[model samples]
Target: MRWIAHIIVNAVLLLALAGYFQSIHLSGIGAALVASFLLSVLNIVVKPVLILLTLPVTVLTFGLFLFVINAITLWLTSWLMGDLFTIDGFGAALFASLAISLFHMVIDAISNND
Candidate 1:
């Protein structure tokens, strides 16, 4: 149930990103759904390892490097998912990551019954 909720949140974030840019097309809701699922899996299974590997930089930057890690994770997600989840460039990936992070906060708040 928690995983399902996470995927739904990702789907919303992806849709939001699409709305932000006129060039990006999501194919359809189903493609967005698949992208969301893939993103969740990538974050869960791949993110921690990447974070740990970059822990030194994370600490050095006073945790700011986490954002970089997040962007990289999203970029890798785009690669893994290919056409379904396209990120046009680094700037797009960075903004998309930040947007998704903010969206996660919203989801967390709502899920916590706040």
Candidate 2:
């Protein structure tokens, strides 16, 4: 259903990130899928709490701190997946998070139009 499509889009975005960044690596489509699923889960379960905890900092930064939160989530996903999904450093995770966010926004916009 819609959830499956969202996961597949996320996997595709992960593969695209791997193709664009030397520091980002995905073992295969399976790894990308797993990483995407884990990322989604973490975003759902951990992101809200993180945002709540960091609300003051996020407000001070004009909402830019959300990018840091996204990068942390990405790094966590890489850590959970171990070698299968690797982000070399915080820089790479930040860039990957930006790219993934952009792609997801575009995809969501397109889907919403239909």
Candidate 3:
């Protein structure tokens, strides 16, 4: 299903980011998978509330504030993951969130995930 594809893609993206960014450290594919799953869960449960709460800022910023919300979610994931998946700080999380968002956007478009 779409969910499986999204998880797999996000895991791959996490691995790729870990490779490219010294600030983001991932233990292995297993960690990536777990992080990916947790991120999916957070997106489903937490992201909506974040979006709603930040609607004014989001709209004011022309929807760019969503990236900040995504960064917060990534930071939360890193916290939940402890040592297995670590991002240096909000800067790294924000960068990773942007990269992940770009990749997901591409994947969604190609797969007609709408």
Could you tell me every candidate's TM-score relative to the true structure?
0.87, 0.93, 0.94
Cα-lDDT of candidate 1: 0.79
Positional deviation of 40 in candidate 2, in angstroms? Answer: 0.7
Q: For candidate 1, lDDT tens digit of each residue in 16-81?
A: 778778534476678788888877777888889988999999999998887777888778777777
CA deviation > 4 Å runs, candidate 1: none
The candidate, 1 or 3, that scores higher on lDDT is: 3
Best by lDDT: 3
lDDT of 2 by residue, 11-105 (tens): 99899889888999999999999999999999999999999999999999999999999999999999999999999999999988888888888
User: What would the per-residue lDDT of candidate 3 be over residues 1-114, giving only the tens digit for each residue?
Assistant: 979988998999999999999999999999999999999999999999999999999999999999999999999999999999999999999999999999878877977855
lDDT score, candidate 3, position 88:
98
Q: Rank all candidate structures by their lDDT, best first, as comma-separated numbers.
A: 3, 2, 1
Pairs of residues clashing in candidate 3: none
Steric clash count of candidate 1: 0
